[model samples]
Target: MPVVGIIAEYNPLHNGHAHHLEHVRKLAADEGIVCVLSSNFVQRGEPALLSKWARTEMALAAGADLVLELPSAFACSSAEYFASGAVSILNSLGIIDCLSFGSEEGDIDVLKTAADILAFEDDDFREILKSELDKGLSFAVSRQNALKTVLTGKSGQNIEKAAEAIDQPNNILGIEYIKAIKRFNSNIEPVTIMRKGQGYKSLDRTSPFSSATAIRHHIRELPDLRAISNDPFLKSNMPEACLNILIKETESGRHPIFPEYYSDIILHSFRNMPAENIASLPYMEEGLENRLKRAAIESVSVDEMVSKVVTSRYPASRIKRIMFSMLTGMTAEFLDELKSNGYAQYIRVLGFNDTGRSLLSQMRKKASLPIIVKPAGYKKLDTLAKKLFEHEIRSTDAYVLGYRSPGQRIGGQEYTSSPIISVR
Candidate 1:
């Protein structure tokens, strides 16, 4: 089967996601659609509103043939590494024909041009980037300025437009996807689907294709989903099937998990974690861990904790990743070793349909990494792979602790859970 891979958070499946999937299906045609979705946490450095399993069901219902988990190491990380991890998994499968993503610009040529410049960062580019950083600009701003400076120096190119492209969220992610494809030297073609409706941070629900932020805000405004059936506006933002699944999950007290729900765990973990240990976390740098440690003792809430540590150079998202890494016991030493290895050791399947099964059958023959369709499958992995996967399992256990229903807070969901097999 010809398979197309998508890297997404799918925090909750909304109309924009459905629209993207429809375009992906059109691009794949008779091919299967495979997705590498964030598990428990998202790239935005927050817990997913819905569980991975529910999101998998939503993807399956929305025409995705297969769903795979992007481990927490990648799921809650910055865009570059997140794309790297997801693309690596797709490439390892060896069956994906293309990598599809939604982008505001929707132009592959422009994204590739920028990605090529970044992937091949020369001495001049590095110097420019260093100069920008020396000016005390944030990494994002520095990188954009450096890229724009470099692009403008090039002859006969639309430097102005190319420079502005990286400032947008989707375009930046698209560039990372392209860079990852190049890094792996994979054969998967890159495709960008034009994004619809309000911008990424917009909270407007008037549009049919509202942002995930908007959808979450809309859901949070209500006391309960008891009136969901009558809310035409809410239903219009998402697919009916996905909306139903969300309602059911919420009713069971499993939907809409916010970061604040797990603030106590994070706060306590931070307070107890020795100052020496904080330096060992991936991305913890320049005595920022000490700042975080101090904030942990001083702050009363997750928002305040992050706010206290956030600086121009270190954004809230970056702070969240560091905090989450600490919560999940992700160490700088371990992540550095993992980066040296430079490949996903295992593929953890989240869900599949008949077409996906066929794709999996083909994957078994072509894949370079171990394909795990169940939690018990972790036992068959090697020592290093097992250690890496244990982090994922621990993250799931942490995720369940935030569920609204105490009765549903059972752990070992990763160990006992089987992949969601969609009959569709």
Candidate 2:
């Protein structure tokens, strides 16, 4: 049987996610379900509604055979790096045969064609891209123009159809996934599952199925999700109720689920760091720093800060990635080191299932690095893992304060929850 890999952040393990998993398994039924997950921070600039460990339990319970953590560096990165990191780990494991993902359109061939063109930008394409960008067109529009100029020369009708198809949000990410697979030259086959329910970033509060952003906002306001979703994992949240669940959990000396520990640090960094320094943050391109600096002084909530800095041309998502990089200290230099390694040498086991034990045993025979399922304390780890884990805990601790007065020093590797779960 082949093993398939799914790279995801089940931020809250909602119903749409459950559908994605079911569809992926059906597409690659014979393959073992391996998922590389985001730990604390997500690609979006906000904290996860649930912790990685919690998310892991949710996924394994859903259907995944095994789950591993996508190191924090890659977890909170832009779409390009997020795809790179998750794809690299699956490639390194050398076990996956098919890679499956959810897309607005399940047209894998179009995505692959787009990926092929993106992999190598020609002179014509580059010139068109530059001209459009100089004219203040968004990168998406710039890319669409470049693609059209190149493809329309030969297949005008085909190019028109492809242009309309490729411009959607999910399709863009799917292309990135294909690009990452080619970049690694991995043996994994690629497939796309069509998305069901509310559209991406849809603000339709009326739909039981909403975007993760909407659900998160709803939780903050209502906390009670059972009335909202038929999702079992979310429905189980009782007594805790909506946003108060997070609030009460933090007050009870629990981790705030995401790397919430960095709120003050992020605030301080924004407050003190110069506009020049902010520009150095990852994905901070084309004078976006001035807006960020201004927002730092004027905005209060993280959401408010992002909104203040976002421009139609620059886009909020890119700005969020930049601030997230700053919050986590994932400097470009650190990214360079990770790039050199290709796959981070550490498999900081985020969460797993019944098959995880078998997979771990299999990995030991061929793997080059240590896969630590449980991180006990600071005393035992090497420099790199220790530093990463500590910062994660610090972010967790700092985040909990919004709800409680839990004052305790988190050691180098002192995670309140078990770092890994051999979920058998």
Candidate 3:
């Protein structure tokens, strides 16, 4: 059977996600819809509102035919690497005929053009970009402006849709996807589905809801979800269980699960390691290692550390992702080694259903790579995918530990939350 792959973070399987899945299903009626998902930690460098298992089950239930986890390394990266990682994973799956992504622009031709031009950055564009960066514009903003000027100046391609061109989140990511698709030269077709509402970071709560950012903020304010449940925006798709988990954490006076896991690790890495070593931290770049080293030593909270290092040049999001890697014991070298393996060799199921199982069975003969029915089942992948699974498992453990009364056994909660979800 033909399969279409969607690279997503489902983050919480909200209404927007359901809409995308539904659209892909309708568009690719002749094929199965496979979603390559980021587990636990998102590209934003925040712990997912729910565990991967929960998100996987939600995706399968929502409309995804197969849910495969995108390893954490690629999951928490910049637009380009994120796209490359997701694209390569889909390419490895062999049966994916197309990749459908949500974007502000549905004009695949324009996205394709932008990707093509972006791929071949000539001297003129490079100079303009560097100059803009030198002026303190964010790398993203600089690139966008540089591309626009170079296009207008050299190629006579005036992008009249100026508002549509800049680093509006979904489109930025979509451009990356298109670039990745072109770079790989894989058989998989690239398609961008237009987003219907406020853009990715907009706090607007109109209709089918704003981005995950808005949802997260809204959820954090409520004493409980009852008030928001009545709104068209909150349809119970946001995972009440997950928020309650956070509530438990707050009530128990425990540190947020992530801080609890990595505080010592990060503190140790900061105090003992050289600033140069921070360069090796996954997602570290552009001399931010020294900035991070100083911040890590002085900043008391994650937010403080983030604030200390954030600049227009270094987005707070990127800093969070970089620090997340340090906290998790992940390094750029390790992820680079993993990336060199190139494509996902195992299709470990985060969740599945009748259609998903059917698709899995159909792909067995056609898939170029092994579909890992269970990561825990295989002794070998259990090692190679160890960091990937451990992050997922630890994130879950951290969540469950949040539920425990203060001073409860940490070890007990770890395995309790790590139970492999049975795919029936």
Q: Largest TM-score belongs to which candidate?
A: 1
Compared with the true structure, all predictions reach lDDT values of: 0.86, 0.67, 0.67
Return the TM-score for each candidate structure: 0.97, 0.83, 0.82
What would the C-alpha RMSD of candidate 1 be, to one decimal place?
1.4
| Candidate 1 lDDT tens digits, 1-424 | 3578998887788888898899888877767999998988888888889999999989999999989999888888888888888998999998999988889888888899899989879999999999998887778789999999988856544455678799999999999999989988999999887898789989987788889998888777877667766677778998999998888898888767888988898999889888888888877777877899899999988999999988888888889988887777778887777667774779999999998999999999999999998788889999878887999988888889989989999988888888899995
Which pairs clash in the backbone of model 3?
none
Clash pairs for candidate 2: 219-243, 223-241, 223-242, 223-243, 224-242, 261-395
Which of 1 and 2 is ahead in TM-score? 1
| Backbone clash total, candidate 1 | 0
What is the C-alpha lDDT profile of model 3 across 280-361, one tens digit per residue? 8876666777888788789766777778889888888888778666655567887777667763445566666666767777
**Highest lDDT among the candidates is held by which one?**
1
Per-residue accuracy of model 2 over 40-135 as CA lDDT, tens digit each: 678775566666666676677677778888866777776778888888777777567888888877778767877888877778789989998888
